[model samples]
Target: MVRRANPAIQALKEETYIMSAVFDHGEFDHHEQIVFANDHQTGLKAIIGVHNSFLGPAAGGVRMAPYARMEDALTDVLRLSRGMSYKNALAGLPLGGGKTVLIGNPRTDKTPALMAALGRAIERLNGRYLAAEDVGMTLADMEQIATETSHVFGRDPKAGFGGEPSPMTALGVALSIRTCVRRVLGRDDLKGVRIGVQGAGAVGADLARQLGEAGAEVLVADVDPARAQAAASAAGGQVVGVGDILFADVDVLAPCALGAVLNDETIPALRTKIVCGAANNQLAEPRHGLALAQRGILYGPDYVVNAGGIINVAYEVSGTYDAAKVVEHVQRIPRTLEQIFEEAADEGLTPDVIADRMAQRLIGRS
Candidate 1:
């Protein structure tokens, strides 16, 4: 079962990967719904992946990424939406999973008109899916989207909405790292702990500051020098070369940037005792989880540890956006990771596999 992308959308998605115009619906056939949005007037072409809604309304973020093909975008939204389902369920949120993607270069293509068109497309879905800020999308963009539809989250704090979830996401990852460190090395605090953070964007910058506050020596690496410098300034950290983040001899390697950064090429070079972060799909493949374990690295699955953002916005979806409650909930992320660590040790499975099983049990019942 496959649907080829229309010509208009195909042309819109070719800004990232250099490829032909071929497109398909991708491999994840268990999706609850898939919406292809194209508004010629606004030049908005996006795809929303609603992976599951049995637990509650599907909630996730909208990312504007340059993709080579429509199929690449679909594949991403589907996987990420499904990951959100698992992420929310494990975090004890009363929400399911969904996500979106606007195909274009965020640098020069973003506009209020495009954002509103995406919002209208989301409005068509009613409450089946909720939107927040994701990669390449900003809170200001969410505001423009809100002008067209009320089903938006992550607006500016001045507007009295949930605001950006990246800080919360970074906080969650820090807590998860503490959990991993405590259980693995019997440490009580992060003081003097060496942490290498890849990607110093919104979430990474916050995570770096959190690490500094916790007394950890932070090394930040980003492809963008300006972003790397800002992160270092934010956390009083040192900026490492981009190639060093994956191989540096740090106690914990936190990936705060893009997904699939940890692959066969880099896994063998990791010297960290703990692998955790705010990036989704850190493992290039499922087998990479076991690889981390085989090398004696305590692996904290991406979805499990980086769920603070979703937990923050989940409240907004339910109309009870409370800051304190969100923080309290995020604090429980470490306990959740502790349980997974214990279970994985007993069952000889990686934390990623354990987490997936836990989410599947709930998904199956739902």
Candidate 2:
């Protein structure tokens, strides 16, 4: 008797072949799927990149930005999606990595119709990807997306448990920074320790507040002067100029902004003992991790430190959202960082490299 080939298996083979060809160009990173979506009526343009699904459905946030070019939007989505994969794996969440980028200014261009269109696009993926809140999006914006689909996380608060993730993200980064201080500075407390926080957005502001509450001296900076002043006021911190934040003479540098800030030029100027924050893809490239290491900087791999937000959303996805459980899970972040640091020491490798290898092995990439 002859048997028929499973359609899913055949589809996987075809996808593998196509991806192999795309990989040769050095842009593709073994992503399982990429979808370009447009809606003429709503003037919505978006790209969704699903990096992997070995653990479960791809889960990530949808960020809206007024990217100057389509290519820039694509690059951000690809890098963010890949980062989500490593983040989830390290956090031990039963979810894969994916991300969506909406190419428009969220403040001026966002509309209910546009969000609905984006939701429909997510529905078309048939649960392969889940959308949550990210930069340029809010809980209310997520509600707009939820109007069209059920495959969404980081929704409105349920029984006052799960909602926006930035606060939790800040908590995780603060804890990880404390861990770094302990490891590199031989201090268990943050008392009087100076911390320079770049990007006074949601996560950065909250992180500055947390650091201040922990007895650390927080210096805040942002592209927007108002935001920087507000964050500094809230945290009782000093507002540093954006240009000088990177070179602030501090014990720690927390880059809570966009990616690629730790490039060739910034690494030499980083005047801190540790590099750790809520930013995704903080290292401009893999080599930048080694460069940080070479400079005697203890880098707390960004993905590992920023998993609290994802952990919170994962609980929302599991159908039973428990605030306590989510916090407990986030608390494990420092332990993971400690393990990564120990392994890096033993292997004589950068923490980021060690973390990437560990996450890759978890996701069947290695």
Candidate 3:
């Protein structure tokens, strides 16, 4: 007698083949759900990835960029959502990881109607995921999203109960930098330390200002010349060219902009002893963490150090947003980094590797 293939197994195999054909599996970490949203009337094309929901509802900011292809957008959402899970788990937040990527040039393609349509898409998730502000998004955009879905956070302040999280994120990065300085440079302060900040956005500029006020000589750069100048002025620092900031002879290189900046070509050119900033998905690949370690550069894992924004937003969900409480919570970042560093040293591994293990265990994936 001849046996036949199980019908369920055959169907799953076919589905897997179709997904592989459509998605770049390299970045498609075991996500729980992936939603492709299209609205012809508003021209809204978006992808939402939920990596985990074991802790609670998935939460992450909404990012809009002019991605050349939908495949690139899908890869971005997958990696970002996975990062969100690690970030929230390590931060001890009762939220899962997820992200939404809007495919368009925010400056040109975004409209109130488009934002409302995106909100409706989020509403259809029925609280499975929560959205907030991210790159190319602002409090106004989040407010517009909230108009359609009650699942949005990171809006403007309401009697200091809730507000934009960029500043809080900057504060956490600054603290983590200080922690790195203490561990590597054996210093209790940042006086006279030369720190290069790449990207002059809200968090970068604020971080530069804090670093400058702490007496570190700051070098800042942005793709936008005016924004770079503004960040420099605000920090009382100097502005470098975008290409030069990464290779600047500084004590630390803070990538506060986009992801995948620490990949192959850029790692060898780094002159800094430490890399810590507010950017998500900074490691182009997991191996880059080891590369940084091989170069004697102390790297504060991006998700671990840049978790302040999510922590701030989580408070609003609890209806217990307190300024002092938020600061106290953000301050925990350094302790977490210190733990990762200590364990990495003990195990002869990079901090990112240790961090990933710890986060995995926390999320019960281990």
Which model scores highest in lDDT?
3
Ranking by TM-score: 3, 2, 1
TM-score of 2: 0.93
By the TM-score metric, which is better: model 2 or model 3? 3
Most accurate candidate by TM-score: 3
Q: How far off is residue 201 in model 2, in Å?
A: 1.0
**TM-scores of the candidates in the order shown:** 0.91, 0.93, 0.94
Total clashing pairs for each candidate: 0, 0, 0
Q: Which scores better on TM-score, 1 or 3?
A: 3
lDDT of 1 by residue, 57-176 (tens): 889999989999867887788788988999999999888899998999999999899998998999999989998899998888999999999988988777667888998998899999
True-vs-predicted CA distance for residue 73, candidate 2, Å: 1.4
- The digit string of per-residue lDDT tens for model 3 on 260-333 reads 99999999989999999999989999999999999999999999999999999999988888878988999999
Q: What is the lDDT of candidate 2?
A: 0.92
Q: How far out, in Å, is residue 170 in model 1?
A: 1.1
What is the TM-score of candidate 1?
Answer: 0.91
Tens digits of per-residue lDDT for model 2 on 27-117? 5688899888899999999999999999999999999999998778878888899999999999999999999999999889999999999
For model 2 the local lDDT of residue 78 reads: 83
The all-Cα superposition gives candidate 1 an RMSD in Å to the true structure of 5.2
**lDDT: worst 10-residue window of model 2:** 18-27
Compute the lDDT for candidate 3: 0.93
